[model samples]
Target: MKPLALPSGSRWSAAHLCGLSVVLVPTCFLAVLFIWPVLRLLALGFGDEAGPFHSYLRVFTVPAYREAILTTFEIAIAVTVLSVMLAYPVAYLMATVSPRMARLIGIGVLLPFWTSALVRTTAWIMLLERYGILNSVLMRAHLIRHPVAFVYNMSGVLIGMSHVLMPFVVFPLYTAFRGLDRNLVQAAMLLGAGPLTLCRKIFIPLTAPGALAGANIVFMSALGYYITPALMGGPAQTMVSQLISFNVSEQLDWGMAGALSGVMLVLTLAAFFLCRGVLEKRLKRRVVTAARPYGEGLSGRSGAGWGMVIAGCAVMVFLLAPIVIVFPMSVSASPILMFPPHGLSFRWYHELLSRPQWAGAFFNSLKVALIAVPVATVLGTLAAIGLARMKGTFAQILEGLFILPMVVPAIILAVGLYYQLTPLGLTRGYWGLGLGQAVIAMPFVFLTVQATLRGFSRDLELAAMSLGAGWFSVMGRIVLPALMPAIVSGAIFAFITSFDDVILALFLTDVRARTLSRLIYENVLQDVSPTITAVAVLVIVLTLGLLLSSLLFQREKS
Candidate 1:
C-alpha cells in the first residue's frame, strides 16, 4: 500500500493553519493584555478634553513636569556613567581570574542582581541613613563628628540606582573581555607595552562597545526606575516614573500619567533599538572571528597591576555590602540598625513569622507565580516553536512584537493594565495580576526556548514523520525532551519575575491581595521595621535558590 499525498496548495494551507494555531494564543494574549492597554493609554494622552495634545503640551510646558523630565535625563546619564565606570574593573577581574574564583565573584555580583530591587533599596536605606550602620561605624571609629546624611539626597539616589544597574554593564563587558584575542594582548606586551598603555591601546578600544551597550541598557532602565529613587532620593531627585505614579494614584490625572508613560515608552524603545543595533554588529564581528575560541591563548592571570585588583575587589565589596549587612542586621537584638548588630538574636525573624500580613503576602506571591509561570511557559514554548518554523519578514516582525513587553517599562504596563482592567473589574483579583505577570515572564521563556530550538535538528522530526510518526509523536519523543532543560530554566525565571514583582502588585492588587514584595514596599514607605530585615534575608535566600536551579538547568542544557 502507498501513502496518498495531498496537493501542494493543500499542504501549504495546512502548514499555514498549523502555524496560526500555534501562535494564536500568545498573540491574542499579548494583544488584549499588552497592546490594547498601551493603545488605550496613548489614546487617553491624546484625547484629553483640553486639546488634542494637551497632555503632551503640559508635559513640556508645566514647570514641575519639565523639571521632572530634565531630572530624569540627568539621573539616567549619571547612573549610566557610574555603572560603566564601576563595572569595567569587575568585568576585567572576572575575565582574568581562574574559573573557580570567577564563579565565586559571580555569586557576589548575582546575589544582589537576583535579589529583589526593593530589598536591595531597603538594604541601602538601612546602611546609609543617618545613624545607620555605616554612619554608626564611622562615628564609633571617630571618622566623623556627626552622622552624615547619606540618603534622601542625590548621592543616595546615585548609589542605589548605580548598584542596581551596574550588573547590566558588568555582564556585557565580561563577555567582551572573554572574547578578546589573547595573542594580540601578548604581542602588545612583548613590544614593551606597560599595563596602563596596553589598557589604553587595546583593552579599552576592544571593550568600549560592550561598555557603551551596557550603558545604554542602564540608562534606559534607569529612566523608568521607580522603587530606588522613590525610596532613596528626595524631592529634587524625582524621576518620570514617580511622576507618572503620582499623577495616576494621587492626582487622579490619567491624562498626565498617560502622557508621561508615552514619553518614557518612546525613549525606552529608541534606546532598545540602538542597543540592538550595536549588539547585532558586535555579534557579526564575533562570528567573523569564530575561528579562534573565546579566551584562547590567554593565561588565567593577566598583567593587571595591584591597583586594578584592588579596584575590582573594592567594587565587589560595594556590590555585596548591602546584602551582607542585612543578615547581621536581621539577627540584631537591638531595635536600631547598626554594624556588628550589638547582641545576636532572632526576634526579627520571630516577628516576621508572627505577622499575618507577611505570611499572607508570601503565599500570595506563590499563588501568582504558580499561575503565571505555567501559563507563560506553555504560551512561550508554543510561540518559540511556531516562530522557529516561520520564515520571511512577517516572522521577523512578529518576533519583535513578542519582545515588546520586556522592552516597555513596567510602570507603563502597570498603569495601562489598571486602566484597561478596571472597567471590566479584572483588577480585583489575583487572576489579572497573574496574567499581567505572565506578559512579562513570557519573553524569558520565549527567548530561552527559541535559543534551544536554534540548535535543534529538524532532520530528526523529518525522519520520524517519514517513518509514519505523527507530529505529536515527534514533538513528544524528540523535541520536548531536547527542550526540557531550557523550559525548566525559563519557568524558574518566570517564577522569579512574578515573585519579585512590586510594580504590578501596587496597581493590580488591593490591600487584601498584596504580595510579599508589595508588603515590603509598604513597610519601607511607612516606616523601617526590624521585620523587614528578616524579610529581605528570606527573599535573598529564595532568589538565590531559584537562580542556582536555573543555572543547573542551563549547565545540563549546555
Candidate 2:
C-alpha cells in the first residue's frame, strides 16, 4: 500500500498543534490544582497584615526546629546508604539469574511496595515493640535480661524505613544491571583483572548512575516520611514531616508549617539537581569510553567466591528481616507480640475481621484506589501518546509538568488540597480523597506509559493509518496492543500509589472516607494493636499477589 504523504510544513504544524495541546492541558491542570495551591500555602509563611514574620523567624531561630531538620537529613542519608548496600546484591542476583528466576525475584522485591507505608510501619512497630519477637526470642534463649528498646526510637525508624525503601533501590539497579553488556565483564576478565579490580574499575562505574538515581529517590522520600517515624520513633526521633503535621493540626500554626514545607521543597529540588549533575557527568564519561574494547582477564577465585556470595546473602536476609518478623507476631496467641508463640492461632485475623472500623476502612481504601487507578491510568496514557507523536516545545514542557507530582512533597499537596477542596464542597469525602490521590498517581502512570511509548516504533501507527483506518481505529488496533504492557504496568503503579498514600488521605478524610493507611496511622498512634498487625499481614499478602500476577503476565508476554 502507498503511504499518504502530507506536505512537510503542514505535517510539522499538525505535530506542533498536537504537542501544544498535550502540554497545555496538563500544564493548566497542574497549575490550577497543584502549583497554585502550594504557592498560596507558602504565602501563609510570610504572615498577613495581622502579624509580623515572627513565626517564621522564631521557627528558624529555635534549636528544636534546627534539630528536626538535622535529624531528618541524618535518617534520610542513613536509609539511602543502607538501602543501596542491600539492593546492590539483590539486583546483581536478578541480573545474573535465569529469566524465570529474575521475574520471581523481581516480584519478591516489588511485594513490599504494594503494601501501604502505614501498614509496613505498623508491622515494624509490632516486631520492634518492647515485648516484641526480637526481645522475646533473645530473652527465651537467655541472651538478655530485659526487653530491648527497639521500637519508639531511631533504630526502629531506620529498620522500618530501609525495609520499605529497599525496593526502590532494587528496581533501578536491577534495570541498570539487566541492561549491562555482559561482554564487557567477560572482556575485563580476559584482560587479567582481579575480581575486586573488575568490580571497582568496570561494574561499579557502569552501575553508578543507577545507584545514584536510586539513592536520591530514597533520600528524598525518606526526608518527608511521617508515618513510619511517627509510629516507630519516639518524640525525640521526630522528623520534619511530623513537625509540619504537628504545626498544622495540633498547634494550628499554619505559618510555621508553610515555612517548613517550603524549606523541604527547596531541599528536595537541590538534591534532584545535584543528582542530575552527577548523572550527566557519568553519562559523558560513559560516552567517552564507548569506543574502547572490552577489557579481559579478571582474576577468578574458586568459581565465584563463596565468601562474598554468603556475605551478600546474609545482607539480603537482614534487609528482609523486619517483614519476616511480622508473620509470627501476628499469629501469636499471646496478647503481647512474642516470638515462637506458645501456640499459634488465628485470633488476630479474626479480630481484624470482627472490628467494624478496620474492616470498613479497608473497603474504603480499596474502593478509592480502584476508582482512582483506572481514571489516572487512562488520562496518563492519553497524555503520553499525544506527547510522543507530537513535535513541539509545548509537548516537552507538558511532559515534564505532568511529572511534577514526583518532586513535590505530599504533605504540602495535602495542605493545599485541604484548603482548596473545602470551598468546592469536596473536602472530607471519598471524592476529595480520590481526586487528591489521582493527582499524584497520574505522574507515575505518565512516566510508565511514556517510557513504553518510547520503546515502540511509530511505523505501526503509520501503517495502520495508510490502510485507511481512522485515527481512533489506528490507536485502538495498533498502538493500544503494543502499549498494553505499559498500560497494565502503569495501572498497577497507580493502584499501589493510591493504596499506599497516607499524607493526602490524612488531610482530606473524615470518618466516612477514611482510608486503610489513615486508619492504620490512627491505630498506631492511639493504640498499637495486634489487630493492626493482622491488617498489615493481609496488606502484604494482597500486594505480593498483585506483584506476582504482574510478573507472570509480563513473563508470559515475553
Candidate 3:
C-alpha cells in the first residue's frame, strides 16, 4: 500500500499534529525509561575520577579482563561459523520437502527456539554432565570405560550456544532457498552437474547474502550471551558479559562495568552496520545478474541427495534433543536425573507446586507479564499506526530510535536500570522490572504491527470517517478489530519476551520479588534438581502453545 496522504491547509496540519502526538507517547516512554539510563551508564565510564579513559585503559591492561574480551570474540566467531554450517542442510530440506514435512521440520527447529534458554541449558546439563544420561548410555554399550567430559568445558559451551543460535541462520536460509528458481537447478542437473558441483556453483552463491546476515546476527547475540557460558563453560571460557556482571554484583565497580558495556555496545553496532553494508551490495549484484532464461521441459522437482538428507535428519535430531529429553526425565521417580525412569510418576510436578519459592516465583512472572504485555502492546500499536501515517526522514529516524532497545544488549539495559533505580528505591518491586521488560518487548510488537499495517486498507477507516464517525469511534469499532490478528500476534511476542527474561530480573528485583527465570538460573547455579526438569517441561509446553496460538490467528486472518 502507498503512504497515506492528508488533506491540505489546517486539515493536514491537524493530521500531522495528531500523528506526532501518537508517536510522542512511545518516544517519550523510551527516552525517559530506556535511553536516559543507558546514556548515564556510559557517561560513568568516561567521567571517572582518575581520568576520562581510566576505566577503559584498565579493561585492556588487566589480564583477566583482556582475556575475557578476546575469548568473547573467539567464541562468538566459532558459534557463528557453526550455526551457518549446521543451518544449510535443514534449510535445504525444508525448501525441497512437501509442505507437511516442512511444517514438521519447522516445529522441530522452533519448539526449542521458542522455549526459554535457561530450560534448554538445564536439559543439556542433564544430558551431557559427567554422570549424565549420554555417558551412562555409552558406558552401558561398552563404548567407553568412563564418562566423557561434556558440561563445564569449552565443548559444552559450543554445543549449548550453537543449539540456541542456529535457528537464526535457518529461517533466513529457508527464505533464500524458497526464493530460488527451480528451473536453474533442473537445467544444471540435465547437464549432468553433480550435487557437489551444483551446490558450489549455484546454491552457495545465491544464498551467501542470507548466510552472512544470519552469521552477523549470531555473532552479535553471542557477544552479549551470559546464561549459557556462565552455566556450561569453564573459567577459561568466560565472556565480556560475565565480566560486566561480576563487576556490578561482586566487585562493586560501576565504572568498570560501564566501560565494558561501552566496548560491547560499540562492537555490536560496528558488526551490524558492516554486515548490513555487505548484504546491500550483494543484493544489488544479485538483482543485476538475476535475468536467467526459463528452462523448457524442467517440470521435475529437484530433491536433496542422500548425503544431504541424512545430514538434515541429524540436524533435526540435534534441534529436538534437549526438548525431547526433558519430558521423560521430568516424570522420573528417581531423585537423580536418569534417562530411563525408575518409574513414571508426577512427584516432581507435585514438588514444583508444593514448594513456596517455586509457586511464588511462578506467580511473580505472571504478575510482571500482566503489567508489561498490555503496556507494550498499546504503546507499540500506537507507534506503528503513527509511523505508518508518516513520510520522511524524520519518521525513519524515529523508527530507528524505537528499535534501538532491541539492538542494544539486554545486560547493558539491566545494569543501566539497576544503577539508575537502585538509588531511588524503585527496584524493590515488580513494577520497575515490568517497565524494564516493556522496553525490550515493545520492539517486537512494533515490528509485527507495522508489517500488518503495510497490508491494511486505510479505505475502511476513510469510509468510516466519511460517515460522520469520530477518530476514536473509527479506531475502536473498525481499525482495531481488523488489526486484531496482528495485535494478538504482537501481544504473544511481548508476553514471551517479558515472561522469559532473566537479566532484568537479576538486577532490577531482589530475592523477595524475583522472577521464575531468575530463580531457575540461581537454582541451576546451585543445584541440578528433578523439579527444575519439571519446570522446563512446563515452559516448553507453554511456549509451543503460544506459538500455535499465534499461527492460528494468522490462519484466521488469511
Candidate 4:
C-alpha cells in the first residue's frame, strides 16, 4: 500500500508526531525524575518556622557557619586566580602552535578530567603527606632538613584544587584563541605595532570573554568542591561543602544542611551572573571599537615578549608538577610515600588487583558507566537535533531545561534524588545510581552534540527522502554516519562523567552497587592507606586509555 502523504503545510504528519513523541518522552522523564526532585529539595530548605527556618537562622546567626562560608569564597577566589595564571600559557601555546603540538597540549588538559575527583584528591594526599614524595625528595636533596608541612593545610588544598581546576580555564581560553581571526593580529603587526602593543590592544581584548568564562567556571566549581579540601586541607581550611556534609552525616542536621546548600546555590548563581554581565559588557565594547581585520603581518616576536612567553611556559610546568609527581609515587614499594620511590616496584599494582573492595568497585563503576554512556548519548543527541529542528519559545525553553543539570550543584541534585527515588524503589540500586548519573551526564552530551549539529545541514536528509529512502533508513545510513564524530565525543564525555561522579553515587548506591569513586571516598575518609594512591593511578591509566582509544578511532574513521 502506498504511504499516505500529509497535505501541504500540514503540521500533523506521522513523522512530525513521532518526533514530538520522542522529544516528549525525555522531557517528561526529566520533569518527573530530575526537576521535581530538585524542587522538593529546595522546598525542604524553606521548611516551616520551627524546622529549616530556625536551623537556617541559627546557622546564619552562628559565627562558625559564617566563617565556613567566608572560607569557601576565599578558597574559590584563590583557586580561580591560580588556575588562570597557570593555564594562560598552555592556552596560548594551544592557540599558536603547530596542529600536532596543539592536539598534544589539548590532550594534557583533558586527561585529568577523565579521572575521578576523589582519586585525584587522594593522589594529592600521597604527594603532600609528611612522609609523602615531595618531602622525601626535598630532604634527600638537602633542600630541607625536615619534612615540610604540606598536607592537611591550605597550601595543599590550593595546589590540588588548582591542578584539578586548571583545565576549565585552559579549555575556554584555547577556544577563544582558536576563535581569533589571524588576519586581525597580522593587520596590527603590519601597521608597525610592537608585540606588547598588539597583545594589549588586540589579542587580550578579543580573548577576555573566554578568560572571564573560564575563571567563572573554575570558581563556581571550586566553591562547591568537597574532595580536595577534605583530603588535603585541615579543619582550618574547611569549606562550606565540608560543613554541609558534616551537618548531614556527623550531626544528623538535615535542616541546616539543606539551608546551607540553598545558600551555596544562591551564591554560585549570583557569582556566575555577575561575571557574565561583566564579560558581556566588555565584549560589547570590543565589538563597538571595530578593530582592524586579521592576517597582515603574522610573524616575528620582540625579545621582551619572548621572555614573557618563556615565563608562561615555566608557569605551565609548575602547574603540571603535582600530576607529573603521581607516577613515581604510585610505583613506590617503600611502604611509604617517597620521591624517586627509593626504588620502583609494581607492588602497588598487585595490591590494587588483590583488594576485592577496590576491584569490585572498579568493575561496578565500569558496568554502570558503560550502560549510562550510550543511553545518555543517544537521548541527548536526539534531543539536541529535535530542539534544533524546531523554532519557538518552547524549543528555547526545552533547550534551557536540558542544559540546567550542568548549572545545578551536584550535592543538591543528590539530596533531591535520594528523597525522590526512595519511594520509587530506585534508591540504593544500580538503576538508581545509573539514572542519577545520566541526569548529570545528559547536559554535557547535549552541549557537545548540539554544537556539532549546528554545523550539519538537514538538506542531506531531505535529499535522501526524495530518493525514496524511508525516515529510519535515511537516519541510519546518512544522518547517523554524519553525526558519528559528535556521538563518539559526547558518549566519551558521558561515560567519564558517570565513571567519576561521587556525589550522586554516594547517595544512591548500596553495598551491591558501589562505584569506584565512592570506594575512594570511603577509603580516604575512613582508612588512609598507600593503596589509595595505587587505585588512583589505575583510574588515571584507565581514563587515559579510554580517551586515547577514542581519539585513535576518530582519526581512523575520519
**Among these predicted structures, which one has the highest lDDT?**
3
Every model: Cα RMSD to truth: 2.6, 3.6, 3.5, 3.4
Worst 10 residues of 2 by lDDT: 290-299
Alpha carbon deviation, residue 161, candidate 1 (Å): 1.5
Candidate numbers, best lDDT first, in rank order: 3, 1, 4, 2
Instruction: Kindly list the per-residue Cα lDDT of model 1 for residues 150-245, writing each as its tens digit.
Output: 999999999999999899899889988887877777778799998889889988878877897888879888889999988999999999999999
lDDT of each: 0.87, 0.78, 0.89, 0.78
lDDT of 3 by residue, 453-554 (tens): 999898998898899999899889987887888989999999988989989999999899999999999999998999999999999899999999999878
lDDT of 2 by residue, 1-558 (tens): 985556777856655565566556656666777888889888888884556676667666899898899899999999999899888878876666567777776756666666677766766676678877677778889999999999788899888889888888887787667656657766777999887997799777778888998998898888888778877888788888888888888998888888888888888888977997888788777643333222122234334455444655675666556566678777888887666665888999998888898879988998898768876887788788878867656565676678778877788889878877888878666887887788899898889889888789878777887888987797778888888877887888888888888888888888888988888878778987777778877877777777667667766766
Which consecutive 10 residues in model 1 have the weakest lDDT in total?
Answer: 287-296
Q: Work out the TM-score per prediction.
A: 0.94, 0.90, 0.94, 0.89
Selected candidate, larger lDDT, 2 vs 3: 3
Superposition error at 386 for model 2 (Å): 1.7
Residues 311-413 of candidate 4 have per-residue lDDT tens digits of: 6677566555555667777787788666667677888888889878888998899878876787688789888777766655667778878987776778778
Off by over 4 Å in 1: 1-20, 278-304, 553-558
TM-score of 1: 0.94
Q: How far in Å is the alpha carbon of 117 misplaced in model 2?
A: 1.6
Q: Name every residue pair that clashes in candidate 1.
A: none
